[model samples]
Target: MRGIAAAGAYVPRFRLPAEELASAWGTSHASGIRRKAVPAVDEDALTMAVEAAERALSSDAVDRDELTLTAVATTTPPAEEGELLPRLVRALALPKSVETATVGGHTAAGAEALSRALDAEGPALVVVADCPEGDPAEGDHPLGAGAAAFVVDDDPSAPVTGTAWHTEETPGVRFRERGGEEVDSLGVTTYQRNAVREAVTDAVSSLPVDPADVDAAAVHQPDGRFPYRATADLPVSNEAVSAGTVVDRIGDAGAATVPLGLLAALDDADAALDGDAESDANAESDTDAESDADDAGDVENEPNGAGPSIAAFFGGGTAVAVAVEGGLAVEGIADLDGGATIDYVSYLRERGYVVDGEVAGGGAHVSLPNWRRSLDQRYRLVAGVCPECGSVSFPPEGACQSCRSRVEFTEFEAPRTGTVRALTVIGQGGAPPEFAELQQRDGAYAVAIVELDADAGRVRLPAQITDADPGDVAVGDEVRATVRRIYEQEGVPRYGVKFEPTA
Candidate 1:
């Protein structure tokens, strides 16, 4: 009965229109796609995973103390050689004793992570994140970025009814070299179509329920057109498949595609069931006795028809099928509407493909040991409260800033949502060498001293303002903190909290 107790997703606020991409390369837009989600310059697979994981955990379906394992799947990790699970674990504030695992190098890794979580001994969190890159000139412009997370446990409300998997050697469909950044394809349309069809058919056929009876189907989509063509022969209807399709707006999110699509289907099913329940309640409350009797009889005869059942299909070189019986929609799923659109050159700059000249040896550098010691303050916004004066000091300075108290200060976690107390705009060429690249990618940004209300007192901390223009931000604006890449030092991406205007 292990199933998804809760689920969450993250789609970046920045989008690149397909027409803009086509204009840059002077080609037709990728077939059946309007726009693709693009991660901000400070975002990557790890950061996006953190965003999704936090949303999933906020549901409180699985308590943090009860979580025993954390598994992450991603094709585009921040670094190939380092351990990413620790960072995720720290960001989520999970127990230090929790087990961790990283899965990647293939697009099917997301399904593998979910399977492991279902089979594990205790409750586990499965996170899938990817920022896929493809050369536009090579006809691979649909690759995009996104993340999704699920909490798996023995929850019967959303039971996992059946599961199956299929794998085969299908080379040259899509792959990357050992040290390559871009995913390469051989344009083997016939070969790719055959592989997707065979894998999906075999996997779906193994499910316990009849395929035609499935209320919804979520299939891996490398593009908008593939899912429909692959599921054409299946017993499921086109409307059922279309309920889970998301690539038309978000593009190909690699490991995150199927999971994101499944979430969408589950949300739709939950909404429908809720609407039906409300209607039934209203009919019973009305003055009509015959309608009540009819509804009662229908419920008695259809005891098994509580909620929509969903079929999920994952495919890369490997394919997995999972049947889900019921669902409870997770809150805070990223809204895909109204993202800021950027032109092609700005997109290139954000992706690091086109950088203005590099400046060497400028910004302040912190040693690994120092950075490690301050993770709690940076990631969780932990502050220190003065025992005598009750003043809060951010970064937990040993002494009280108000009364100069020598006594040990109490630790406190500052609120993430706050008000801007002061602000300044840093124009181009005025940034330190460390921020030179960021300044180049995003011209003229704002810095704000935000005041966060803590239990003991107010704490003011200086941080860079993101997702807003320098000219637009003001002293009274409301903002929220989110983890993002600050800069890279010694081959590592440093992460810190940045403030964005509250939606």
Candidate 2:
């Protein structure tokens, strides 16, 4: 039951142009970036994870008795918020018998999730995908919409082979401390590099398996360049690089980067199970796992019909690398062939009526965040707290927290941004079906209690940070929410809203 049986990738339907992103950043990768998949309108970490999981399952058969669900939630970099694993896991169509869990606290938690999945009983299905926060650093602006997945099972056609990994723990370089009103990024390059070197080296060295045996790698990162630098000394071959390196194109994907790296590898090598396996069994695999040779891509069952084996690894910044290996072939369930321009204004107001920046006499004024010039639209969120008891809800609801009041409406979008009311990291999340990897590099996706800047007695709510580090999150920071993928079904745009970092 253990070979990479099938694979799938999910790129959100929305695609931001390189020009737009570059314009916002004051500099850009003219060619554009391939940001990780993000759910649309109504999609969330759970739904995005499932979209990728469904794609992974579409290509293969997963035993209802054997499905084990695990996940990690991430946000865009600059816009700090929090990860919502609990909310997400429930969205999956997984059977009542299946076991499900949430992993968070740090970006690297994904690695830990990988490790757990690897140890699951029987043939297991592992899916990894992301919706990294968007603004922390605007890393997701260029191509920040989509999801990817791999199913790890015990099947033979395609299986995963895990090797060595280690921990590289450091306190400073990158931290997302959420205080009452804001998030602080005390990230120091020198410190990050020093720690990255230590953990990556330890993981690689511990493997003892020839660096040659290890195919190209995916690092826990938003940008693609750093991984190359970290593995410089390792025997990583160039042939195994993923397409749309973020460093050059999309930017950083936060918690989703590593999975995105794996997705990039899978996409670049569409049929990694068949054609790529044949053309580059040993060496090319180290560099390139497979290729998208034709439509209806299929890999012939091996002599035993067992598929090619893969070794998806997750290395977190905590200097910890967890390895998990299993089987399942997964790929995009929808077309990832197009890119779209984000219209935050239309996008936002279209979602009902979003207004977060300022207010006027009768209506709220929507002053798009600096990041929105490229990504048009803000979310039109309604305030739905219990009318009698006093509770806060994003979308206005008929029921109440205290008195279930159907009337007493004061609907509005997030007020004047907000701050981190509370936060936690995410690990293990939306994954490709049949994903097999030990543990991700130590990483954590953040989830935060967002308090609106509006005057509703410090409007507070929960949100997922779009594009920054969990450790870097803090309370009391200003932030604005926007419409992001709340979830999706068969590639349709399911919309909702989330928050991003704001200056």
Candidate 3:
């Protein structure tokens, strides 16, 4: 009876076109992809997961304390040593007692995380994200960056019936050399394609319902064509499986692919239900009008429920098939439009491959005690509210600034959407060493002072601008807060919220 209560996805705002890659490398074939989403210089797998989790939590309105477990699955983890899930937990403001785990090094880890969430005793959160490394010459197997998250509970809107899985200890199929950035792609396509197809076939045969009766279907997409190719021999048709097919556009998101495809399938199901409801409403309205006029009309209301949806998630050596019923409504998670395109040089710089093969100055070296002490203020942006004057200070200082009240201050809620009040352009020679790569890749970025009017009082914050042209941003522009990578110090990636102009 466990299923998805809510779902959400995150796609980066920058895209790299295949045509541009071809021009840069002088090779026409760039994985036959049109374009792929590119994370900003300040974006990564963890931040994208945070974005997706925020959307999922917003749609469900579940109390943070009620979530008993949090799972994050990613092949490209933020750091090699430190725990990743705790950072996500702190950022989302979940209860410290919530159990956390991280699954990695395989594309199928996402399915594993979701399966665990489904088996939990209470509400659980599963997040999948990846930023794979590709060959510089080949453009990283045409990699794209993104994340997806889902909330799972017994009384879920989309209930999962069961899962059928197949796995083996297949080694050397896909791997990376030690201390290498590029993944070796030797003989990977043939082995992976056949292995996935065989495993998926076996999985489908175990389902109770006939494959032909499935309302919608999705498969793990390594390339744009892999899904269609793998599912061709199955009983389902291409149209029925359209929701899970996204590799042609967004490229391969590694562990994030299956969950994103699941979101798409859920969205398709939601749209169909909406259409049916709207049609039924119209029919009833017409019937009412006819009854009022003493004429004749007939109207029928259909029962509300979700049909069966089949999904297959592939890891390097494993695959899982899931059948879900009573699917939930999807927020706008699949919209991949409106992104800025940069050239190959800019892409290289953005990915931190420029500047003598190192990111500038390695940024700030934040100590452990300082980092742990400011978790609430740094991650969740929690402020301190003075009980006497009700004024909020972002750092949650010891004493209230407004009334100098010596009493314990109330913790203010996180910042909401705000507008740019004052701004300045940081051109070349102005960016800090930590952001010099950003300046080199994207010229003349804006640093703004943003203002928000809350119930307590007016709040002002200084932040950097992303996903916009410096010339286009103005004082009155409205913006939303998003988690982004600040910098890496001592091999640790620091993340914080930055404001982006809302489109």
Number of clashing pairs per prediction, in order: 0, 204, 2
Error of 3 at 278 (Å): 8.8
The most accurate candidate by TM-score is: 1
Superposing all C-alpha atoms, what RMSD in Å does each candidate have to the true structure?
A: 5.3, 16.1, 6.1
- Runs in model 1 lying further than 4 Å from the true structure: 268-275, 278-316
What does candidate 3's lDDT look like per residue over 380-404, in tens digits? 7677787788788766767777777
Off by over 4 Å in 2: 1-6, 28-39, 68-90, 134-145, 179-184, 242-251, 266-316, 319-329, 333-337, 343-503
Question: Residue-wise lDDT of candidate 1 within 1-503, one digit each (tens)?
Answer: 79888788888878889999778778744676688888888999988998888888877576877888899999999997796898888877899998888999888888889888988877899999999887867445787788999899886457788888888878887788889888877788888988888888888888887877665577878888887877776887665566567777787888887787777666533334444543542342231342234335431112112234454545457888888876666554544444789888888888887787866774688998999899997889988877788777776776778887776778877888899999999998888888888888878889999988566687889999998878889999999988888888887888888999985
Kindly list the per-residue Cα lDDT of model 2 for residues 204-285, writing each as its tens digit.
5665345554433555453445565566666654433333133233344345556655544344243443553444444432
lDDT score, candidate 3, position 306: 30
Q: List the residue pairs that clash in candidate 1.
A: none
**What's the lDDT for residue 315 in model 1?**
45
Q: Quick one: best lDDT, which candidate?
A: 1
Backbone clash total for model 2 is 204
Find the number of clashing residue pairs for candidate 1.
0
Query: Could you give the candidate ranking by lDDT, starting with the highest?
Result: 1, 3, 2
Please, what is the TM-score per model?
0.92, 0.56, 0.89
Of the two candidates 1 and 2, the one with more favorable TM-score, higher being better, is 1
lDDT of 3 at 268: 37
Error of 3 at 221 (Å): 1.0
